[model samples]
Target: MKNKSGGHRRSKSARNEAAAGNKNGRRRRNKSARHGATADDGDRLSKLPNDLLLNILERVDTLDAIRTCILSKQMLNLPTMLSQFFLSAGSIPGHHDKACLFSCSEVFRTNNAVARVTDNILCTRNPKIAITKLKIRFILMPHDSLTIAKSVARAMATQKVGAAEFEIRTEKDYEDCSPADLLQFAKQLNNFVGACWDTFAGLTRLWLCNMRFGELDIPNILSTCKLLESLHLTNCDSGTDSVLQVKHAQLVELQVDYGEFDRIELTCLPKLQRVIYNYWCTYEDPLYFGFVPQLSKLNLTKTGIRSEKILELSQLLANVPSLSDLHLDFESEKIWVIPECPKLLTPVLSKLQHVNLENLPEGCDLAWTMFFLEAAPFLKELCITVWDHWCIMATDPEFRKKYGFCQKADVNWKPHVPDFKHKNLVKLTINGFQPDDGFMEYIRNILEHAVNITEISLYDRKVCGSCGELAPEIKDKVCPSRYPQTDEERKQITEGLGLASRAMVHFRS
Candidate 1:
């Protein structure tokens, strides 16, 4: 060897030593040494096995993943391993702060990483199991206007990605965002969008809207997401052609707010339990609206509809045997003259225990109570809002204002023979109770007849308009019985009533 070359001839160890290269090569050599094997040892130790790696990632949240990326150079690409990525923000990053905190650029990169992970995991020649749940939550200031769609599509890839839950919540002032983004997302995934109807193969929940949308689009979305168990759609617009046909049998809860719909039919869902429609503009009744028998709770507030619609809804709602809670509040500055709310007797309300009828017309309390009693015969609690007795006496022109006394007409008189033979009655609360014969009689009847009664509350207005005078008769005297004991109690009650009266005036105006 010395004769052949001027330099020393390369030996096996020398060649091996020369081959030992950068940090990665040195680490490989070290790993082999640690295992007590040859440098060419095929058996390699993995930081995490395939299954275990996926399992560990399944437990780690998105923030923790980002934290992990900073842990070591080895974890630099670990974000690509996760099928689900969540970016949660508490408050919108202000202008001075980094807009990149939740900027479109960051989301774009994150979404690209998510896509790569899906392709690697799901499209592998021998693809492993796909992720079942992908949840992306944006809770703070107006979600980056463009964040939702990219997140949704990354969740809805056709070949392998399964069920996904997307939640985007923002304050009411993010007006710059458009509804087209949502519509475009749905339209893009129209094929995968039918996941809800396929039983266990679809989306479980979808909460969309801090913006407005047409009604037709919403029902289509609902129909596609038939397997959806809980759905919340707010500030959406619907058209006459738009029909809400809930065809899924697995839906449990639905909340639709400030929308308009032409026909809402629910034949596909058999397991639906609750529905809340607030400030909606729809007047169309579902073809077989009340045929379902398993629903439990319903709230329809400020839904501009004819009296006949309420009666129809009530009749339909009565068929459900499991309903227990009901709230229907329709109030306005202009008088709403509608047929009396129908007496509901569905098995659904058989166990109803609590009811709240707020902002009802003044003289409707007795009739409202009667309607409530007929529907929820088993009711144990009720709340009614009306003007204060003292306020009426002082403010009503019909009354000789100055003292706490009001004429019958000034009181919005509704003659009623108060009786509580129902026996199930336990607690009673009357707001705006002033010292008047009608008011006194109402209170006395509840205390006298409710044998099971234990607690009774009477709140009076802060300003007593009745000049503290009576009609001067034994039968009509209001101060004869059951009054608060101290000035403090009286003042507290009066203050509460006064505040409540002011609140009503504010609400009504």
Candidate 2:
């Protein structure tokens, strides 16, 4: 009986050992599963090819792209491969907090973050890689500007960047901030350009806005950018300067909008094919164009015109012998006065083809309209938009003082008829057409002169809030026009104008 009891105790001990072993095995399996998950999550992005990764980064903002560098060991050097860098303070993550109370501290924090990311990428970029473009938009803080200038200089010193665009803007809260900061930023920019003069020689495009510089700096800066093809200056100024002259051989396109300069002279831009000039300020100095033989398109929007000046338009167009497309917006001002000398009215724009005139005041003599018809014998299309009362009231006071309200000139002061008819004119479009004697006479002159006219379009001034500024909430509620036209009026205009049989007429209200 004692031997049997010993054997049973040994079996019980064996069972206990078996239970412990099973528990240990289960623990080991659970640990393995946890580790497998972590390994699977380990830096899958690192598997992508470097070129593919760089392309992906290019589509994202530069701030986000730089932040990816810290993701893993493989991504540490990825930002160095970027060919294009675009940094904007407003685009930084977490910069736009949805809270109603946006504090100054948040602005500072956002600006600091932008500076840190930009400096890191620019400083660590591969010197051998050629950066094709670098664009930066940020507020003009004094210390930040200096830091940015230094960073740019360092990057330019190491890399072969082809184009650089800088946009200095004011913060939303500081829109009306003092000009002192802008002045300081401009000084830093001048210094940077001077230090990196040779590096900018291969630059193809340059754009700057809301900066101030001296008159002498303008020429100096352009002289270095010998290969620049396009230049745009908006709301820029030269301190205490009246004239800004741009002379470049390789420049193909130039735009100057709302710049605080009295006069602008374009002298040696032989390859310049397009020019856009728009300024609303009152200035009497004329724009002098010289040697621009390839100028094909000229757009003038709300440009100040001097009615007292003689042959102003003629002098401006004399140099652009190849001009084909012309767009002019008088901005509801009547400055097209008859020139004193008939010879001065003659401009041989033989190659001109398309003309677009907008915001022409009502009841004014058609002499200004006739000037181009007689000048461009090969013109193919002419579009005119008549001004409404709202547009007339919005005209600047200086413009109104210089050129009084629109009125027909004395009956004795009729424009001279062209020696040659408009044989090539094909299309005529008159928007906001009114049934007045002056307008009818204008149409009659065109019908009699344009032998090859094919189509005429007359559109009554519809109630159009599209042309005027309306509040977003009330835009849908407001009626477009107070007076709706009847179909009978349309028929009367068609019959009164004696629509030419060769031309098809389309009338719409």
| TM, every model | 0.51, 0.66
lDDT of 2 by residue, 363-456 (tens): 5665457666776778999999876445225345565556644432321244466544778998998887767787778887888788888888
Runs in model 2 deviating more than 4 A are 1-135, 142-164, 170-185, 195-202, 280-283, 303-311, 336-348, 389-415, 418-420, 435-440, 458-492, 500-503, 507-509
Clashes (candidate 2): 2
- Which segments of model 1 are wrong by more than 4 Å? 1-86, 89-134, 138-164, 168-201, 210-226, 283-291, 303-313, 316-318, 329-348, 358-367, 384-420, 428-450, 455-509
Candidate that would win on TM-score: 2
Q: Which 10 successive residues of model 1 have the least lDDT summed?
A: 500-509
Clashes of each: 21, 2
**Each model's C-alpha lDDT?**
0.49, 0.68
Model 2: lDDT to the true structure: 0.68
